[model samples]
Every structure is written in structure tokens, then in C-alpha cells.
Target: MGVVAAERIKLTSTRSPWWCAALVIVLGLGIGILMAVLSNDTEATQGTDPFILSATTATGGVSGFGVMIVMIMAALTVTTEYRFGVIRTTFQAIPNRAKVISVKAAVVAVVAAVVVAIAAFGAFFLAKGIAGSGPTIRMGLDEATWRVLYGVVLYAALAAVLAVAVGALLRQTAAAIALVVLWPLVIEQLFLLFGDIGKDIYVWLPFANINHFLSAHGSTTADFHWGPWGGLVYFVVFTAIVFAISLGLVNKRDA
Candidate 1:
């Protein structure tokens, strides 16, 4: 309990997290508004009835760039401490290095989850309201819709844990941020360029599976062995493995 409070104070004392959070809210809501406006224009131009806004489409910004920012913030929480040698003091005070890291991960994950939940739902309803009324745009809370809304919150929390692990392992801000941001946005997508083999490998990529889970329908064309829940499980296991490795190294290595 003391460790958790200390971690929370350390996190909130920094300005980067707050800035990152603000950026997330802006991206989530701003992009949602843009998507809605564009969709409205498309419907108007086509002379068609208003299009049904899929939850996936509505919350694209939140789950996409917004979550990435959250991961970067989470990574920075650890890397900045190492950069300034604050981690050594923290370790000295706590003595249980694993507990400190675990508590930090938990604190960041909880904060990330809460912020993203608000942004996700805000983006969804804001988009729905802006897109206006139509028979198809009933804003129904169907199973798929609910999944897209909540899946982002789950993804953000897990991704924060992964980012914290990466930060602790690397202990360099730039490298940790690059790996977390690029792995999902760039490296994962690069696999698609490899044609059939890439498609097959893509089915197993962590972010790909996460996207599959968050999607209203599965996001990827690659054949996954499991369904959405299974994809989530795979991601959870992957994150836990990475986090465990970080714990081992942090305990064995110098602060």
C-alpha cells in the first residue's frame, strides 16, 4: 500500500504524463469528430441514408494513436527515473525492487485504463451524436459495440504494463519509446509486406491480436486460430511473460 501510494505520487508529480493524457483526449475526441464529419459528408455526397457508425470506426483514434501515447507515457515513467538516478533512491527506500516495479506497473496501468475508458466512451458517443440520426445510426449497445468500447481500455492497461517492462529492461527513454511505438505502428504492419508468410506471422503478432480483439469485426485478414477472447488471452500471456522477464532482470541487475 505504501509502495502504491509512492508510485502514484511519483507519476502525478511529473508533467509528461499529464501532457500525454491531454494529447490522448484531444486525439481521441478530435479524430472522432473528424471521422464523424467526414462520414456525414460522405453520406450527403452519396445521397444515401446516414451510414451506421461502427464502434471500430468511431473509436479509431482512441484505440490507435491515443493508446500509443499512453504506452509512451508509461514507459517514460520508468525511463525518466533511471535517467535521473531516482530509481536508485527508490530501490534503496523500498529494498524490494520487484515490488516497486510491480506497484509502478499497477499504478500506471490503472491510471491508463481509467483515462482510456473515458476517452473511448467519449469518442463513441460524441461521434454518434455528431454523425446525427438515421435508421442505421441508432447507437445500439450490441455485443460488438460494447467490445470495441471496452476493448480499448483493456488494451491500454495491458500495453502500459508492457511499456513499463520495456522501459525497465532498456532503461533508456528513446529506445523504450521507439520499441513500444514502432513495434505496433510500424514493425507489426511491416510484416504484411512479406506476402503469404507475413500474413501467417501477422496472425501471431501481439498488436495484431489486440487489433483483432478491439475490432468490430476482426481487423486482420490473416487467419487466427482463436477468436477475440483468445486473442486477448494471448496478449495477456505475452505481456505477463515480458513483465516477468523484466522483474527477473531488475532484481538481478543494478538499479
Candidate 2:
């Protein structure tokens, strides 16, 4: 539809989104190379799977950082308009404010997802190159590496959508981003410190549980898993619930 295409163009025309996309690629690959270089001389610990360490380290600790930035970008993308009074112009142009927001959400989600996928694959190859032939697994179209390859992108994109939903509640980029980022790190940690319930309750913590994707270990609970696809599922459900709540707000709000 013309509306969707128009929305896409508007979304992509912005410089920040493009720079964020570039940053995702550059930071991701940069970390991968750093991991390979730092970890090159180190052999896989005997009895431990090299692939696990390879996945974890060459992928590195920066994985969580990408998700947070992605969420911040999403939050800022939607909520910033409210602060700038751009929402009035956007709605005035479209007239169908509901559809505009819906399309905007969909457009942002899809674009972020696609960019993350490309970045993940690019990072994989960049890492593979730095690793050389040293203690490396086979890379091909039909390998288990495919899971790791796509999971990075899937997780990042989902994080953005979830943030968009959360942003809708606040409608302010700064507050939404602060709350979204701090929720898992600070507040969740505090709640999780209380007792045994902390472990169980925190296990379902939306963004934190996403790391379960990268874990070779397993989930702590039944309701907390989607199996090997757990990370993807966790993010999907989180994104959906957030978006649903945002939809209610969107319907109620002026723009």
C-alpha cells in the first residue's frame, strides 16, 4: 500500500535510524574481531565444547548491549515525536492516526529486524575470518551455526518492538528508555534479590530471559522456555504483550 511504502520511506529517510543500523553492524563485527584476536591463542578447554565458547565469546559479552540500544532506538523513534510535536503533523497528514501508528510500528519493527539479521550475518563472517582455521567449526548453509547466526538479529529486532510497546505507555523517549533499560538491570535485580520467588519470578523477566537464547544451559522453569527457540519466543511474547498494551493507549490518546 502507498501508506506502508510512505511510512517506510519516512522511517528510513531519518539519519539516526541509518546510523543506528550502521552502528549495529560495526559494533557487532568489531566485537567479533576483538574476541577472535584476544581469544586466538587460547585453545578450547579440554572437555568443554569449543563451539560454546566460540559462540559466547567471539559473539562476546556485547550481545546484551545491542538489545538495549535497539530498544532505546525504538523507544526514541516513536516517543520522540510526541515531545517534538511531530505527531500532530504526522496525524494531520495521514488523518487515519490509528492506521498511521500501526503502520509505523510495523514498519519500524520489520526494518529493525532486517537490519539486525544482516548485521548478525556480517558479524558472523567477520568473526569467522578473524578466527581463521584455528579450532573452528564448519560454516555452511545447513549448519547449527545458522541458529546462532539468525538468533542475534531476531533477538535485537524483537527488543525494539518490545521497547516500542513500552514507549507507548510513557510517550516520552527519555523516560521510556530509562524505564525500559533500568527495569531489567536495576529493578529486576532488586526484586530478584528478595527470595526463592526471585529466581522463579525473575526467570520470566522479559529482556533478561532473552539471553536464554545464547545459553547452552537451560531454563530454570517450564513457563520460561520455548526450547532451543526460547529466546525468540520470549522476545515475541514480550513484544506482543507490549504492543497490545500500546494499541490500547494509541486508541485512547489523541495522537
Question: Best lDDT goes to which candidate?
Answer: 1
Which segments of candidate 1 are over 4 A away from where they belong?
43-52, 135-138
- Best candidate according to TM-score: 1
In lDDT terms, how accurate is model 1?
0.89
How far residue 54's Cα lies from its native spot in candidate 1, in Å, is 1.2
lDDT of 1 by residue, 110-173 (tens): 9999988888899989988897865445457899899888899999999999999999999999
Clashing pairs in 1: none
lDDT tens digits by residue: candidate 2, 1-255: 877997777777788888877777677778777666654545542346554335545554346555566777788877888888887887787777668767777777787778766656666677667666644433334434666666666776667777777777899877898997898668877755767777667667765566666543444432463565766677678778778878787778876
How many Å off is the CA of 79 in candidate 2?
Answer: 1.5
Q: List candidate 2 stretches off by more than 4 Å.
A: 43-52, 133-144, 189-195, 216-226
